[model samples]
Target: MPDLFLLNISASSIFDAASPEAASIRQLTFEFIIAASAVLLLVVILTSYITVKYRSKHRHEDPKQITGNRALEIWMVSVPLALVILFLFRSLATMNAILPDRGNHTPDIIITGHQWFWEASYPGTTVTTANEIHLPTGKRILMLLNAADVIHDWWVPALGPKMDMIPGMNNYLWLTINQPGIYDGACSEFCGQQHAWMRIRVIAQLQPDYERWLSEQTTNTHIPQDTMAKAGAILFLESTCSSCHRLKGTAAAGITGPDLTHFGSRQTMLTGMMANDSGNVARWLSDPQAVKPGAHMPRFIFAKDSIRALTAYLEQLK
Candidate 1:
């Protein structure tokens, strides 16, 4: 409800290239719709024609009774078979496109899933963050996924299918955004009470914007005028919250909770599970138990001044 941030988590055209998989999916959807419409139209037309044509004008004899039509039977089986094969072929081709090592592609970042949160690490790059993921538009990036706790699935509907993030196991998926925008993702598998809060955002930006973000994230860039954010940072460090969270350039370095570095800039909070805003952050901070009963994050009962200061500090993470 806070007016500071607006939510936009739909897919962008960055992943819109014509892959065999995507093409098949589109064709399959189209074919199904077309076939269903044709069948419905045929039924309607035949029903109306029969109702009028077969009117009982006089005393009629018994109507003809037919058990089956060989031609119709062949048509039904053959048509479905053909469509299924077409779909499979297209799907396989698409599957190849998404699999790792299929082409000369570079993964922009590595994403690891934790209980009710996500940790992102940029290997070989001095960059690490949580919840929100940023990628350059028009370039394909592979998400190397792993789980820290139980079974969890990462899915962004508009970008692609959901891939499971299981502990001791690794899964990967490729995503390419065609335009600059934010895409929403969720944990498809139910892991716990706060599973619903496990959300993610994929921010696709132009080359320059992405570079700027990368630069900012890599350095200790703090806004001097962001008094509120600074206060929030102080509160986060002073509270028991430090036992579970880690915010770069801050004294609170607890790996037990989600990373709070650049927390305000994310489109969604709680591993992309909740809306990213001052209200939700404050709400989460005030009573995490009520919002996510079994949440590992403890509620911070800050005094009035401290709460405002903490809120200001968090808002400055953008």
Candidate 2:
């Protein structure tokens, strides 16, 4: 639900580490920066001294030309070796802290990456959703990551470390939120033309709120109340939309696309491309390619009445 103006404050940023994993990364980054700065200062000082002392004078006499000094060579070799050892140890420590092997790891959530979107499924529960993910604060949540199609990367800079989602393989990531807020991210790996638009929104709330949200998500699709919504629901089921999307407690069940069980509950459409309003929803239904070029969702060419009805039905899904 973050707008362009709010992104600067809400978007996931590496500098603002908000979890244990991200904090570790930030600490290592700071150490590297400090070491690099010290090395740069030393190099600059030595270069300045040599430049000033060995400058060509107005006199014709030439300065002493000699081979490299043994002390200088030894200093160069020993300093580089010491820094390499230090960095290696620090890096290994960080890696171990982030990826400890606890024999037969189990995950709390399973997230699958697709060509243009993300799907989240709660293990041992009937909760499935797309694009927007919810997490609770003050818990170390292990996530099982996979890709349905090509390679994709899940990266929320503020939440924790980023990991790859490779096809035919599984990856693991740990997310532990420190605060209750919204964090935005995107597909760090380019998989297709719409990769930049493949946005991720994480809603971190308290335990009670997260449980309530999960309960809602576990419920089936909402029933239509009005005549227009009724028609829209029928149209959605009878049309091609049913072939790709799934709406629980209904005949529409497909695995090729994102689930629309609680479509109205979401804030954005096309994986966070636009606002989920009546106009935008109708517009997207009318022609998806016009709204998002190179998108996988095909254009339906729906009539005005049909589009309006579908939009109304979807809006009341929550």
Candidate 3:
């Protein structure tokens, strides 16, 4: 059973990305497996020996009573104490190795976790995106995490450990992806009814690809724009959305909600609780309360045509 369990755990894909942090975790896991297996094997062998050696047959035979053996007691205590100290040192080293150093050249990305969606930004580039984050492979990313309305967590299993996104507070972590790939993660904190839907995708790409994506994201592509998106843009300007959202090169400037400047480019919307397709955006814009109860965004069902037009515009943001 122990071997089977260890095999199963080892077989799982926990070392795909090969990041520095992942390497540390892998080392610690190996130490734990070795120590735990040794302990279990000793217990099983000792128990079996005692059972067979203590078996009795004569009715008049009295079992020998043995007091505690000093040497045996000392060995047991010292062995476990040494093992525990080793584990502690390993854990501390892993923690320090994964955390970002103040002097390290860590790329800073601001992330705001909402009730069900994730918002990310590069202040220097003035680029905002949701759900998906693009990073240059093999480079460290230092994320400054926060929550706009409620608590959320940033967790990428293959990358490193999880960090909390608290309101009015700052939490940070450093991670580096070894290669280009998309990793799946979810908000580990329960913020609202849609907490289960709070998913995020981490995309690590080659440096050139990442730079190209970044340039494209920063460039405004509203040319030959659809009338719906344009009309929606206007309505969005006049509505309460402008009070919470901020869209560069537009009149919409607010920070109470997610940035919508490049919302259309994102793969998912509503904090990764829904696809970025127009239908979901329309439905959400029409009635946020119905689709996601307790959502901070109020329902705008009364403006059906206007919302449809606005959703079309927002969707064209790509």
Candidate 4:
């Protein structure tokens, strides 16, 4: 494992780990810190003692010419090497224990990484959402991860292993959350220009809450009731935008971008980086390239009225 993946962390605060998997990582991190500190203290004390003991007592006399001790040489060489080996083995074992593998059985969720967004689909149901992911607590939720474009890495510091989502290949991660909370993460690998903004928000819920959320996601988006919003929905389906995004049970069946079936239910937009509000959505629709320089969504020249209507309609998706 590269040291690069070891420190991948992004969150509002240090949460009481939602899962034992995350706790194991915390344990390992503390172990690394303690081990490093002990070595540092030993080195400092030894250096200070050596300097004091060898200092010349008389003004004109030279200090004792001390030679290297065979025992000390052997101890120094063997001790560090032994410590290194022990840690190497310990980290590997911890990784195996938390990371999802064949022993984890099968994936309950299939997550695909696009240029700057995350699309998650539940295998057993018709639930697919972007950026914000939800999972039930107290269950071993296995995830099969892949990438649609360049390579990406899914890492949540509080959930344990950082797995790479490579194009044309599959990796895995599992989380058995112990409590209900909101955990945030990001695309650890640099996938593109907007890579830094490719954020991940995970909502771990109790089984009942998770079930309710899942049931909601599985439902098709309702027709807009407001006049402006209804018109906006029509425009959205007829425009070129429909060709890039997918809306469940709608004429918009494109698959090149994130799923928008449950867009209104999501708290954040632009791959979980910005708030999902009327202004943000309007700004994104009018000039996607301006807000996200490297985004694949091109600029759309919509009338101010159209922008407002569209924003209203999108906000009614939930």
Candidate 5:
């Protein structure tokens, strides 16, 4: 089983910086923390000392009134002003380093956000996948983001900053992964009722492994010749399943939903909300809304035998 806790955590706990871009952001964050803590401590100490030293001794007598001291005023204003300028330059330098540069030789990927799922496709190739993206390590990746319906934010804390996917517009972001591992992310924007489940998974692999995965995805879906799987395939085309989903090199060519060219090969389903297994897939097919409210997929009333056959057929898609 995958570690669910590590897959879902607050953005502030970005300690596992897997990429150089993320590490740069983490370093700046720590610098800001240290500077803010020092200022807070100084203010607290001075407040305490002044309060006790100037306490009222008698109710009738008033303390000596005096105008503000020039030295104290100058110190108060200059200290914060200097700190502000220091942080400003530091932030600008970090941004310059992390910003996307078109001069570099980077592979471009298009990412389109729907109501609750993500679709990724490689440019100049027929390789289209959903929810999960495979990337090559030690290479800069340029992502062009757009929204199909509403505004959505693509954010992977271990990669880089968040970029908004706006309708009728395109936004770009870049990241270079130094390590090979799985990084989890989600839509930072509140798109709709099921926005919380709009999750994503990025698998950083070596150059050779990434090439193999890409080749596999570009190929057609495996056509099973077994008795039950063949029947399930017939039923899938006869029913409404093909209306919203698509399977490469098959009659199902609809694009209203995620492409199911390699559904069984994926680690999770329903935008990474549940494990992609026989039991989970069957459950989701029976009632999608029960698993995720406000999901675009309607509740399918499949018979027990039909469900089993479909599950078996889908599991062989790998």
Candidate 6:
């Protein structure tokens, strides 16, 4: 059977057990739904039967009020208690299976949740990027999640369990993707006005592809050859843009915003809020607040030529 959680057919069937941890969660969910549905069906049937069998037309006089029978009372109490106990044990078993195992030798990645973005860094390396996370399929990865500001939740329903990125505290989770695909996620916890726009995308790639991607990300930013792009690069450094954004291999090493070393390679920008096209890039540069309300990037009242040059320079970063 097709995995309902991973299928991108419909919104209702979008969630999938794409990883081992998520599979256990899916199993527990199925068990709970089945159990609850059976109980509901039983209650509905009994209610309908009792209503018809003891209708007013069948018995005009008041039915004899008998104190609850000992068997009936025992069943009423014990059945629900037994069911609760059963579900409790099942849930405990599922939890045990999904818990992070410290003994496993997995690649560690630090995930820092900022106010409206996600930054992922590979341990023991200078590689750092924003919004998108890349993972190698079929291998366990240990994610150390933390928040730079307020609380945020790192959740990819198709990949694994949701974990809270709390300020000053590091929480961890293990995930192993079984397939190569791009999984969409978002911040489940409300942190600020742009909480809903805090999105994430995890790209699970083959081991070789993931390694290549990592190597590319670590490389220096692409140098523009055209006159317009070169001019824009100069302008970027001269203006306030270099104060917040960083471009590797360049003198712009500000860490207040997303790293733009490989900006052109990304599928989306602004934490996946919009496509990484020249038009959107220009729009964002013209008025950031108009594009994304409460965004830390201030609007730049640059001329149309400057915006076009900036967009061209950014698009060549790949």
- Of the candidates shown, which would achieve the greatest lDDT relative to the real structure? 2
lDDT digits (tens) for residues 1-318 of candidate 4: 212321333343334455788888888888989999999999999999998987777779665788889999999899999999999999999888887366738789999999999999998899989998998989988899999999999977677667899999988787797767777788999998999888888888899999999999999877899899999999999998799998899999889999998899887888766778888899989898888998999788999999999899999899
Which model, 5 or 6, shows the larger lDDT?
5
Alpha-carbon error at 54 in model 6, in Å?
Answer: 2.7
| Reference-based TM-score of each model | 0.76, 0.94, 0.84, 0.89, 0.93, 0.91
lDDT of each: 0.71, 0.88, 0.77, 0.85, 0.86, 0.85
Candidate 6 wrong stretches, greater than 4 Å: 1-15, 58-60, 101-107
User: Residue 32 in model 3: shift from native, Å?
Assistant: 1.3
> Considering summed lDDT, which 10 consecutive residues are worst modelled in model 4?
1-10
Error of 1 at 190 (Å): 2.8
- Candidate 6 TM-score, true structure as reference: 0.91
Task: Mark the regions of model 4 whose C-alpha exceeds 4 Å error after superposition.
Answer: 1-16, 49-67
Cα shift from native, residue 233, model 5 (Å): 1.1
Candidate 6 root-mean-square deviation in Å = 4.0
- Could you tell me how far off, in angstroms, the CA of residue 229 lies in candidate 6 after the best superposition? 1.3
* Pairs of colliding residues, candidate 2: none
* Clash count per candidate: 20, 0, 3, 1, 0, 3
lDDT of 3 by residue, 79-107 (tens): 99998998898898888888846565544
- The TM-score obtained by model 3 is 0.84
User: Which ranges of candidate 5 are over 4 A from the true structure?
Assistant: 1-12, 57-59, 101-107
List CA RMSD, all candidates. 4.3, 1.9, 5.9, 5.2, 2.5, 4.0
Q: Flag regions of model 3 displaced more than 4 Å.
A: 1-13, 45-62, 104-107, 221-224
Quantify how close model 4 is to the true structure by its C-alpha RMSD in Å.
5.2
> What is the model-wide C-alpha lDDT for candidate 6?
0.85
Tell me how candidate 4 scores on lDDT. Answer: 0.85
Task: Please identify which of the two predictions, 3 or 5, would achieve the higher TM-score against the true structure.
Answer: 5
